[model samples]
Target: MYTVNQLGKMYNLSRSTLLYYDKIGLLKPSARSEANYRLYSKNDLKRMEKIATYREAGLSLESIADILNSDDTNSTTILEQRLHSLNSEISELRKQQQLVVELLGKDSLVRTAKIMNKEQWVNILRSSGMDEDDMHRWHREFERDLPEVHQDFLESLGCSPEEVSSIRKWSQ
Candidate 1:
């Protein structure tokens, strides 16, 4: 048998956290000392480890409890869902990173357009086949004056200067 403090130390949990688990009936001490100290058994420790694993995988305490109690809950199904969500999050982050890399590569073009005070970004957007109405809506909502910023963003997509100029003229 392990005392509350010993169990807490082993699991890297606070004494209060273990007490809270006890109060919630998630974990019950196997025995109590004559002095009324909480004593956990080996089986309780193993259950705590399972709780920690589920918590690490983003399951809420309530959800973990449900899974533990339910006869129909399948561990494989839960794992597959968590894996899918993590993969989707990773894919989104990768796309954002690629966009940032493309923007950084057009640093020189960005600098030149900023100096010109011309809407080079509008040209860039037009070159990229981005809708004029969408650009107008974006400009109105964002109140951003730097067309060169958009130009740099578009140039990052590998558009030619001629194409960008044509789009800029068409937009006007």
Candidate 2:
């Protein structure tokens, strides 16, 4: 049997986190000492390891508890559902990554256009019918407010606000 501290060190988890797991009845130790210290066996360690694995795979504690406690639920069905969810998440992230790559390419084009002579720039803008004053106003407004607006846009896109804002500014 291992003490709580020993178990925590072995698993690289904090004592409080283990205690919280115990309090929630997620992984109750198999035994206790006369001095009231928690004692865990090999079986307990195996259970904790399984819990950690499920958590890393994005299963919530509540869901994990249900899976562990449910007698009628088939483990194979639960695993298949989790696999489907992970695959869907991966697909969505790949789509977002493709959008980022396209945006970066557009930013490169914009930068190349900016480096052109004034007349060339003006002609390009004229061909596009993009007004100079409007462009300037837009640039200034984006400079001042884009961090927040981009944050909102990214949140809508299911990306981290900070990460999306950084990517948006990277194009500028």
Candidate 3:
């Protein structure tokens, strides 16, 4: 048996997180010491490992709970959904990587990635057949992924406050 702190350390989780899991009925200690400290058994550790795996796969707490509660958990559908989501994300990242590579090839060793100003980025998007909606999605993804960098990039483009506000609002 292990204390709650020791169990959390084994899983690289915080004490409060374990307490929250216990409170939510997602995980419970095998026993308690005379002082009322939580004690985890090997079975609890195995369950915690499964919980961590599901969480890392992006399953919601409620979904994880349902799966744990169900005797015949139909996980194939959920796994397929997650796989599809991951594939789409991979495809998007690949497109971004290709765009970066193409941009880099536009100049010699002296010019850096910073040279692609706002107008150039917009032009590139347009030339790549990115319509208004596609451009908006791209900007929204950019802002969502890196808000500070997006702001700095817009500023580097020398866009006015009104322009920046308009662009951000439209992209959103």
Candidate 4:
């Protein structure tokens, strides 16, 4: 058996977070002391381990609670949803990273990337009579020559992450 403090320290969780979990009916103590202090049994400790594991895997507290408490759980769906969300986030971050790399590549051997709004780029493209096909080829050629500048140029035009990714894909 363990007190809340003991269990929290063992699991690297704060007392308040554990308390919140309990309050939310996420992880109830298996027993109580005579003084009504929360007493977690061995089973509760194991449950906490699972909770921590899921959290580290990027599962939300609510989702963890559902997994722990719900009948169906639907763990496969939960995990798949989390996986897809992570992939989308990673894709966006990659676009931003490519932009930064190109910007730095052009300016200097610096390590940071900055951004501009999208409309500024569109106006410049309009002035240049840049169409989709031309823009597509531009990305390919720019990437072929300068390596990273293609994404940066697109970003300078104020393109969204998805737009940048789409342009890169089509250019390929």
Clashing pairs in 3: none
Quick one: ranking by lDDT, best first? Answer: 4, 3, 2, 1
Q: How close is candidate 4 to the true structure, as a TM-score?
A: 0.62
Model 1 quality (TM-score): 0.53
lDDT: the better of candidates 1 and 3:
3
lDDT of 4 by residue, 1-172 (tens): 9999999999888999889989988889998999999999999988999999999999999888777766654877788899889866865775676666666676685434444445556567768999877766776887778655677566555577698788777777
Model 1: per-residue Cα lDDT over 90-125, one tens digit each: 546544654554567755354433222125556877
TM-score of candidate 3 relative to the true fold: 0.56
Residue pair clashes in candidate 2: none
Q: How well does each candidate superpose onto the true structure, as a TM-score?
A: 0.53, 0.57, 0.56, 0.62
127-152 in candidate 2: lDDT tens per residue?
A: 88778776555545665676555444
Higher-lDDT candidate of 2 and 4 = 4
Q: Alpha-carbon error at 84 in model 4, in Å?
A: 0.4
Candidate 2 TM-score to native:
0.57
lDDT at residue 151 of model 1 (Cα atoms): 49
The window of 10 residues in a row where model 3 has the poorest summed lDDT is 108-117
* Each model's backbone clash number: 2, 0, 0, 3
Ranking by TM-score: 4, 2, 3, 1
> Stretches of candidate 2 above 4 Å error?
106-172
Clashing pairs for model 1 are 121-147, 121-151
lDDT of 3 by residue, 1-172 (tens): 9998998888899999999999999999999999999999999999999899999988888878877777554566666777778766754654465466556675645254444456677898899999988978888998889875676567556555588788777766
